[model samples]
Target: MGVLLTSCSAPSPTPAPRPKVAVTTQIKQLLPATVSNKTAWSEDIYQAFTHQKLETSVSNLCSVIAIAGQESNFNADAPVAGLPHIAWQEIDRRAAALHIPAFVVRTALSVTSPTGKSYAERLDHVRSERELSDIYDDLINTVPLGQQLLGRFNPIHTGGPMQVSIAFAEQHAENYPYKKGNSIRKEVLSQRGGVYFGALHLLGYPANYTVPLYRFADYNAGWYASRNAAFQAAVAYLSGVPLVLDGDLINYQDDKPSQTELAIRSIGFTLQLSQQNIHQQLMLGQSIAFEQSPLWKQVFAAADKKRGQRWPHERLPGITLQSPKISRNLTTAWFAQRVNQRYQNCLLQSRRE
Candidate 1:
């Protein structure tokens, strides 16, 4: 008490690297639902992490959960109004195109399936792609004429709950640990395991981009559209050609050709890529091969040299949403950006916890 004692302060603890932990665990726990959905989400994250060699952390899973939750609310069996009408329209159109009689289609469906249930009953009530797909499978296997008449009736969809791309599933089927002959609907509904794994495929796939919008565009359009659109934009700006930076690599909507192909043709002479080559390349957009092409490399080099720095190879456009519900020039870039903003907020909450 006579002498003043010097206060000794404890050293401050260094914070751990956030990316190492937050990026994996937080993300995994972010995708929430009933017990089943939680299980599915977990399995999917584990499989994706294992297969992609991604860091098994919550941050990465959270980013994916943010997207999936926004897209489908984790419902693999989600329903859409007027889908049955659309499916019937598609069935009629395909049948007409193939010159199959409606009565024949009906008769084939009327035949009893292996389950002893008539396909017509199922077909009449089917209001979603998954249901429609089951009917199609029955027709192909049980009905003799189904093989020839409606073999291509499999309306492989790439959107909606889980934002699952059928093409993506087929491409990465090897990574799926489940047994064969499992229906897409069943695989998609596996709350504790398979569905979540599917969600990972839809949301966890990697992309080298500065923002989440690019990944969203890839989710909607194709994997490299973000980068490809940038290259196309660069080409347009440099070549003085008009182009839309909407991140669409191929237009699968219209019966007409893709707008991207049209743009390519417009500048084909200057780019020295033949129309046939362009078409072939467009076909490869669904796969990873397109990214490895000379065309892609050339564009990157050209874009880099022009910018005098390594600009983002791709970017999400500033545009409006133009879904079936909303018409007018819409952009996935806008949707992704908004969702990403929400994701960031969620990330902050996780960090605080």
Candidate 2:
């Protein structure tokens, strides 16, 4: 009855159709001004950002650009300085580990690959990681010794424009938009696939770090490494036991709690949590929920009381980067700092434009 007499409110004027933000266009616009290969980089990165559904926020975009700049200088097929030597070294190391004769390993690589060149030949001429990865693929598929020597583990752990983990791409490839050619390893070496997977790995996880610096560290170290490192600091403070501040809570290879976990447990009576409770909470270290646990809160409270001041809840993990490729002593803090500097530069570039 009221509807018949009262004038309609005209459907609230449809909220004026709030202007749609053109993320792809924005990315394309921003990327060209920053990257050297303006058109190509913009197109590939835009496609990647769109496919992954990652936020096109300036911070997120700059984070990706910063990592790519530091990793490969935005070259998808970036060349390693001594990749051939590195490949040979890996082969020799693997052979020695397996107790396989060097002659046999040499003979195995001598067999012609699908590309009609011997794997040894490919290795000798290898310049970029993509080339090396292709050779490994050929060997793994065609040679029996390849399976035995490598055992399903590719020595080329990291690849692509952003140098994302090949294993990470393989694991999170459920919604991959590319065709399954060869494997995720090959796709990770491609420009579009690499950026997509790398961006997903870098920005995919939820973090509550106050600064992007922590996220940058976590990107190099591991997810939640920054937060876990802070936890380690707290445990160290409360127990007066020195801890490495490495983000690992437990020994990943076994069910035992790590030194950090042990130190945290030493204060369990004060925390009002049992050993099992601490273990359970620390087990969730890979996730953001660990920050909300009683262990996280109690440890920080106790440590802050001891220090007479509150410690910053995030810090660069004290992990020494151990990789065959690394020639210098590099820590997680160093990597994070470098990336953050690049990230800040990118932000400045964006603002200037």
Candidate 3:
């Protein structure tokens, strides 16, 4: 027998179990003293993960928890103070743009809620995003003219103690984890469990994204920016057109033709799509239906090849995160990087376990 040249392969070492991390305690200690809402924080964090039906590893949850802890510090009722002034200015600007009289806009506010309280009173005193959002919801529901005047009425709220996503909470409420709570509103300011759950909602959902930047963007913008950005970038690249990577899929300007539509027009013939067909396809974006369209497959495949590395299927960073409360640019990029750092650290800790 030739000296048994069938050499024995060395046994592969089994990977180690991830370490048991005590993240919740560290997260708790880092929260602001002003935050009396520990239950709300935990509930929100739990709700964030559970609502998405996200089956996260404990380490992953910790990573997300770290970001939430840093972002809101467990304050569900947090409000950005100068928002009232900024909101008034925006209202004026919008009124002038649409030729809607200032008085009419103000008049719309005079309409009452189910409680018969004038919206003007609510608007004047509105401090938190949630509070303002409730007012808008009531406006659309109760006031007959509300839809015509303030129909596009999601006020952008990006500051204060805790940076909550009003849009996120509104759409994904059923997934919230606090079964014991009477309502989502009451749950938001409850305690650690509630806040933790809410925090997870703001951070844990998954996407086919390559980086956390778009998640930050999605947290700031919406869920599908990553996919839309890839399409936008492909169209821009192929048509030799320059476009912002901000992932604004539609043109909001009053002009009948949108720039995005025009860009699609330039490529329409190449793809053998009629202008009308392209316009119809745009609506699919509001649903996940666009992902099934052949255009998406073709463009995404070509774009991936051209970029060597995978392209991020999300919005580029929007506004830098700045606040009168905090010094420095504190941009979304900075926030994502910090969360990612914690994520990596958590991973390392997991490996050690």
Candidate 4:
């Protein structure tokens, strides 16, 4: 008692906190020598982690660095090889669908724009997404014929070094640190905005993945795609219903239940869940909370018992990536694996230093 009292009375003094090192120094060690403007890249990346309160651990940092490297070898507005051709094609396609004649559309674009160049001329020389966006903005605002032909629609879905979804950026822009530009789309085309939003999209969500590969897949596919794919696997195992394993639990746009949802409904009697119950649970599929839901637990449990083995909860979502930009066969698995290789290389580089 006396010794305890003495120890309590003489409590040790707390050591001073270690001085913080700049994240740029750490980022420099991970970056390749070929990366231009190393300081700028590092600063934006550092601020991304800082603003989002994400752990700037080597693994996390490397993941962001790898994705940026993969998406655009560090260019803020990386030029698309055939953006003008792509843009013109899309414009003509849109006009055709709207029943607007090609010559009328062509004549409208030939008018002098605010840049003192014809819109068609601007489209001809456009190399990057950012430049295309500005031209689109001017077209919609200035030209009466442009509003009739294109309306408010700008088909550019993604931009910037990370090529983040403009829709995703706008939805998550409330917490964006930099208060630049009126539009999130414009911000997404900048270095700071791209990294900030990209990092958030990459690491903002929670997952039970043991490896970063599933998370990488989720990034390409969508949030929680990996987990939902595993659940679909379990459902397929339990019900003898073949599923696409595409990680889509519900068809948000369609009123009819999706295949995965219907599959779960087929075995609802075994799960003691009704179709409504199944759907209610399926609605949570987009979130981490879905992992803890009763449907997730029951499906896996039934599947495990039937097979006499536990099914792995994490699996790469099997999805073929389709985009106007893509000219070859590429899958979500390919993107995930490629980025993961880069991620591992960054880690290896950091270790070597």
Candidate 5:
């Protein structure tokens, strides 16, 4: 009776507190030593990574810096040489495509704009992409003919310090933390928003690449381009049908199978899969799941059997960078290699620091 006050259970163990992550400090430390305006760049990058809830590891930080440096050289409002001429060419091309008279297009642009200059004058004097993008936005929103001619598409495909796709940003703008007054195009031109979306584009997805170089290639091409290119190589090797390793699974616009898909289908009988099964697997080219599909396994198996050794599962996609902005011949491999060089340099700088 004297010992009846014994406790039934011991107290629960206290959980350890997580160490506080100093995001801004980490970013500042990881940034390249040669960067001009390091403070401003670091602040914007920190805000972007934090707001987007992205990992702020040195590799991740350096990847962002590498792309930003290559794309815009840390200039948020980077000037595009001959932007005025580019704008005019686009307007003219669009007008011709829409069958709108040249005079009508000219007259529409001659109207006084919000900035007290004629839209024509603004187009003539567009020193940077941001200026041209603003002009296109105004034309699409205000001018009736503009809407018909441009079809709500602004030709400023890439913007901001990272040159992220405006379309990609718009698609993923649901959790965008900033107040939503401006369109995604406008946001892509801002330092913070551009970095946010660009980082998301560059680091948001899952991949099985052993090196950051493939991810950089995917950034320039499309997601999973490296993997899909490898798949294409396997298909080509097994089927004896040469195919461009562009990573396009399907002809998105039509139900017709892409050349790569068709090549895979040609070997369907050998793989013991139907055309439907092959198509289904190839359709997953955009995602990581494609690697798990039967077609993926069979193609590699066949290729390996033929070669008497296992072929590497990833390769630099053989895609030419064919943007109006790019005057020189460039490939996805070239882009990835260039960015990887920068990334390596950044890594070295971080280690030195």
Candidate 6:
């Protein structure tokens, strides 16, 4: 009789979550030393990472820090240059668009806001986005025609450290770890809420980007805008149908076919997909599944064959950013490059420290 020895090995235990203090310390170091309230920024960002179960890699952490630096320089109540004038301009524009007389609008704004000053007075003194958002809230709730004038939505679409979109914050508020404080809009003005939501917006979704630059572009544009822009480029090259590589697959607002959709329909017949089928697949453009779609595979394969080279998987979306906050001409490429420069600088800082 021969005795046989058998060895049983247990699966390795899952790696423990990184210590909170260690994670927060790394984030604090990456932040610019000149940034006031460094520890607060670190702690808030740490909460965002943990709550979302987002990876705390140096790159991911730096992406959040860099956007904060660019948008607010770490100030939770960041002062927008000439915000008062901008607010007044928007008020007038809204008033005109809503067919409300200027005097009527002024009379409504004359009512005292929650802040001891008239809404008009507060608008004149508005410096930070937080103040502006508050004024809007007071105006909408208290003043007559406030909601109608503002189209039942706050005029200040973005706010806080990273200037995340309020709509985005509101829509994604279900996973928010902290108390939302009256509304998600109010929370978006806080450091913790802002970073959490901004990080969610920036890195929350999965993108098949080869580098962080495309992700940065997606931050400025919409998600998959970079990838879709590449698709648009390939379609244009193959079909000779001039197209704007703005990364929009189909116009969501219109029932009629968008230029991208029309172009796809023109070639989709050859790719053995009908317009209806094409649309069903293009809707997946918002998800990772878009990459596996018949449109994606056939279009890229055709384009790659026609050009004798593989088309880009992703590219910077050609979108010129138009916002009240912007004074100079800026494009999505500029935004991506600027943030990526900060990303590289932060990487250097991490190495040096």
lDDT of 5: 0.81
Query: What local lDDT does model 2 show for residue 167?
Result: 82
* CA-lDDT, candidates in order: 0.59, 0.80, 0.55, 0.85, 0.81, 0.85
Off by over 4 Å in 4: 1-20
Expressed as tens digits, the lDDT of each residue in 1-353 for candidate 5 is 01111122443332332223565666666666666776777778777766666656677788888999888888889888878888888889988987889999898889998889999999988887888889888998988988887888887888998989988999999988887676778888988888888888888876777778888998999898988888888888888899999888788989887898788778788999998888887778898788788888888888898999998788999999987677999999999999999999889877886
Clashes of 1: 19
Q: For residues 221-252, could you state the per-residue lDDT of candidate 2 as single tens digits?
A: 88888888988888888888899988888899
User: How many clashes does the backbone of model 2 have?
Assistant: 0
TM-scores of the candidates in the order shown: 0.69, 0.89, 0.58, 0.93, 0.91, 0.93
Candidate 5's displacement at residue 264, Å, is 1.0
Candidate 5 weakest lDDT stretch, 10 residues: 1-10
Poorly placed runs, candidate 5 (over 4 Å): 1-21
RMSD values, in order shown? 10.4, 7.9, 9.8, 7.2, 9.0, 7.1
**Sort by TM-score, top down from the best:** 6, 4, 5, 2, 1, 3
Clashing pairs in 2: none
Error of 4 at 250 (Å): 0.6
TM-score of 5: 0.91
Candidate 6 lDDT over residue span 83-114, tens digit each? 99999999899889878899998888888778
Compute the lDDT of residue 146 as modeled in candidate 4. Answer: 68
Ten contiguous residues with the weakest lDDT in model 6: 1-10
Worst 10 residues of 4 by lDDT: 1-10
